[model samples]
Structure formats: C-alpha cells, structure tokens
Target: MRSMLKFAFRFIKNDGHRVTAKCKAEGCPWSIHASKGSATQLISIKTMNPTHTCRGAAVSSGPQATGSWAWRGKESAQEHLQGSHKDAYSQLPSLCDRIMETNPGSLATFTTKEDSSFHRLSISFHATLSGFVQGCRPLLFLDSIPLKSKYQGTLLTATAADGDDDRQNGLQEPICEIFKGSYHGYCLRCIAEQLVRDLKGQCSQEVKRIVIEDLHHADFAPNPEDFNASVERIKKN
Candidate 1:
C-alpha cells in the first residue's frame, strides 16, 4: 500500500505538476485536494511553464522520513501558498500601473465609452497631409477593428503608400486609434496635420497627387483646404 501511494505521488508530483522532486520517497503527495489541514485552498490546476515549475528545487514541506514534518509548523500549507500568490498579484498591478503612467503613447487607457471612441488616426492623417504639395503623389488606406464590446468603430491609418514598399502592406504596422464622437471633423483635421509631419520626416520629396478611393462617406472627401490652412498658420512664425 505504501509503495502504491508512493508511485502515485511520484507520477503526480513529478509529471502532473512538474514540481521539483528533492526526494520522492521522503515526501507526501502534493495533490491539489489531498488536504493540508482544517482548511483547503484550491490550486488553479492550470499548466505552469516548465521554467517556473520544473526548474526550481521542489518545494520542501520539511523532512517526513526523519519522523518530523514541516506541516506541523504554525503556518498551514494552504496559508503559505496563498501568501505567495498574493505577493505575485500585488506586484503585477504595481508594475502595470507604472508602465501605463510612464508610457502614454505606448498604451491607451480609457474608462468610459466616450474616451475609447476618440479618433486618433483622423488627427494623424491630417498631420501627414500637411507635408504634401500639388506635385507629390501619396498613398492612403483605411482599415477597421472590432472592440471587446459590440460597437461600430473606425481606425484611421495611412502609409507612404508605395507599391515596392513592403512596410505599407502589412496589418502589423503602427495604426492610429480612432474613436466615435460628435467632433469628428475636428479630429479628422488633426489626423491630416500629423500625416504631413510624418511624411516630411520619412521622405525628402514633397507629395503631389494624393491617391484615395472614392469617398462615398463625407469624411472620405480629401479636403486639402484644412491642411493648407494649417500650413499657412505654420508659415506665420
């Protein structure tokens, strides 16, 4: 009976949990529900990475073969496990909050529907268009993405728009965010100005003929007037 239990524990602790095995013959089965005492804390039972689970020395519950058990200590096994988990959970949120605060451009944080719906790419396109002239032809494209919730939204994106440019072809490129709101026109104008700034940095040549598909939607209309106004404003300096 002891051998059978030992074999079962060896299989479970070694293969199932990927837990380190300091000495299988000297330890009790570390089964999830195998009981620690008056209280039982559930293990997630999810797969653990081999590096995290298998690399570390097996967690010791002290020596049972020496006629002594670490489980006899003041802290129960369940309490020990819960304490470790809480430490990890607490650290993760702190690290994430620091990252969000340090890098606003890298991530977008919005609570309400209004903030999420802000169209960032519309402003970017206007920025890029500012770099264009009558003779320089530029390429533009638009794509859409679904949100976690059910809501129709749009994302404005544009590139140097060249056939040979493989960078222009992939979905992995940095896309500007767009949100839904009443002030879309102002947002759209902002996008155009950013587009111009981006192009000027990327290519030395001026943009002449801008190519876009037919704008059945009113926003699709390539209104260079707003872009021109921004340029005139810049010249006053």
Candidate 2:
C-alpha cells in the first residue's frame, strides 16, 4: 500500500486476505490486485491493469516533493561535511586570518563552541564599508527571501536605497535611477483590485463604466480640478 501510494495510487478495497489498489485520479483505469502468499507472510501481486488514462503527472512521495527540500539539503551537506571533511571546522580560524591578511583593513570573525567547534562566522570587506560610509545614503533595509531547497532557509540581505529612490549598488552608487518626471505610485492594476473589493455590488453599470474610465483620466489629469471632479463623480456613483 505504501509503495503504491508513492506512484499516486491508493487502495480501493483492502482485507487481510486480499487488496485492490487503483490510481488516485478520478477516472484513471490503472489498478492492481495483491493477495497473501501461500507459504509466506509477504503479499504477492496477483493481477494488474497497467494502463493509466489520467492526464496529470503522478505525485511524488520523495523529499524533493516537499517544501522542506532546502532544509533537507542543508542537513545532507552538514552530514557529508561531518563524515568526509571533519577538519573543515578546525580550519575556520586560519581561513579568517587569511581573509584579513589578503584584504587589509577587512573584518573577519568567527566564534566557536566550548569544545572549539565552529559556531558562527561573519566578514565585511573594508572597501564595502568605506564605500557605504562615504557615498551611500544613511537608510538601510533588511529583508529575507526563502530558498526553495529541500532544506529550507532564507537568503538574508541588507540593502540601501539611494537618494533617487533607486537601489544602491555594492559600490554605494545607484544602479538605475528612475526618470525625474516619471510617476511612480499605486499602480493601476492594484487600483483595479481595490476597486473590485470596494465596489463589488454597490454601483450600476453606468457608474462602474464611468468610474473605471475616469480612473485612467484622473491618473493623468493636468489640473487638480479635473482630478477632484473625477473623484467627486466616483463618490456620487
């Protein structure tokens, strides 16, 4: 039964003596029958209908099919390191020293357990720190995006936005700034979603039509009067 489920199949009929398994899909014709062996405790396959008519792919039951694949991978890597590279942790201090020696004025630090096992490590290059202090804006943003591996973890990052509301590069320079005259605000796509949420059953067709049409017009209105008029019309509608 467990083996059958791995191939996106399930048992439709099961008794101690015999079992009939079929595809999990609604209309698929694939099935298999198994019965207890005559002289053994094991079950033996008696018959099978191998033809599957389902359009969708079979579901996987492996670790790769799960959301924790990233975490699983991380654990596997750690186990491999422990098994095949036991000295990796012991070399951290020398690695840190080499980093600072090769890149003068850089920062490199590592902490260890009471038994001198590796605990944590951090580093920051001198050039990056100097560039941030001299050329970048003071604001900092911290964010983390999830990794999709079997062993889940986040890719943490610290970013700085430049004076022009553009992302700062590693050298503290804005990579791509928006044009000064360009408008950037609540996008029309978002506004449309909000409109649906706000006016689901309250307005007639004429009002809905006018409001949607005027939304675009209001977005590019040259004067406050036209924008205000559109707003007032929407309110009345």
Q: Estimate, for each residue in 53-142, the C-alpha lDDT of model 1 and write its tens digit.
A: 231223322245212222222122333344443454345545546655665433333332364432332222223445333222565555
User: Whole-model Cα lDDT per candidate?
Assistant: 0.35, 0.63
User: Looking at candidate 2, what is the lDDT of residue 39?
Assistant: 71
Q: Assess every candidate by TM-score.
A: 0.18, 0.33
Candidate 2 lDDT over 127-236, as tens digits, reads 87776677668977888788543334456677665444463234233222534555545568678667867887887767777888888788878999999987787677
Clashes of each: 33, 13
* Deviating ranges (above 4 Å) for candidate 2: 1-86, 144-157, 163-165, 168-237
Worst 10 residues of 1 by lDDT: 208-217
Q: How far is candidate 2 from the true structure (C-alpha RMSD, Å)?
A: 16.4
